[model samples]
Target: MAHPSSSHSRLFRASLLALPLLLGGAAWAQQPPPAASAAAPAADPGRHMLAEIQVIPRPVGTADDRYKHVDAAIAVIQASGLRYEVHGLGTVVEGPPEKIWPLLQAVHEATLQAGAERTLSIIKVSGGAQAGGPRVEDLVRKFRN
Candidate 1:
């Protein structure tokens, strides 16, 4: 029997190992980033009456991609007199449920204006929940003491 060359053995092991690592990396890359916080309780059951908008603009091939999206979104919301916090996946704007509705509508429009043909949103209302009742600002005010 002939012995395998040392170089050939090393090369064979490298080739075998590379496949799983490459495949694993591809799988990880496909997943979306996680949301910053757990879901807030819906104000009403089966209806999350809050704005959860996502702007999925087509890749613009820019060096500063995030800026393009943020700037566009901010411009649209600001023009409509709404304030927002930029979360990693999207922005979050808080207000009374009624006020939130119109603002969310503007978020949809803003995503459209940002050149996203396919924008998505999850609107739900939550109040009187054990996890944490709504009015995040109120909680903050209480914590200040």
Candidate 2:
């Protein structure tokens, strides 16, 4: 029987390592090409209440500084005749879509006025028939204290 040399042993080990990579690359070869613009946003015309929020000047600095800014912003928003709750560093204010939109705009303007340098993200929540978009109807279902 002939024995393999050191060079042949090295080559054999290298080929073993390369086999899995080659097989994985071949698996991707059969997939179809992607579309030009990818998937489009489907229009949900289900009368959903969508909240348009502007989260300007989010907490970017230290935790204490961020808390200060958040608290101040929350105060201003709270004074605007709305019910709000601050969960951790985020604020959750519930109301009609129309009311929430204006509140978000106010929050953005106030945050800028309070000397916020960081950019804020705007978010929206659309609760369908499940929650009815934070209407005044929730008050009627309140639990007896």
TM-score to native of every candidate shown: 0.42, 0.44
Per-residue alpha-carbon lDDT of candidate 1 for residues 82-117, written as tens digits (9 for 90 to 100): 445555776656544546676767766665666655
Looking at candidate 2, the ten consecutive residues that score lowest on lDDT are 43-52
lDDT of each: 0.56, 0.59
Tens-digit lDDT track of model 2 for 69-101: 445567777886666655454666665545666
Candidate 1: count of backbone clashes, pairs at least 3 residues apart or interchain: 11
lDDT at position 20, candidate 2: 61
Alpha-carbon deviation at 52 in model 2, angstroms: 9.0
Off by over 4 Å in 1: 1-50, 60-67, 79-83, 122-124, 127-133, 138-145
Relative to the unseen true structure, what is the C-alpha lDDT of residue 68 in candidate 2, on a scale of 0 to 100?
Answer: 56
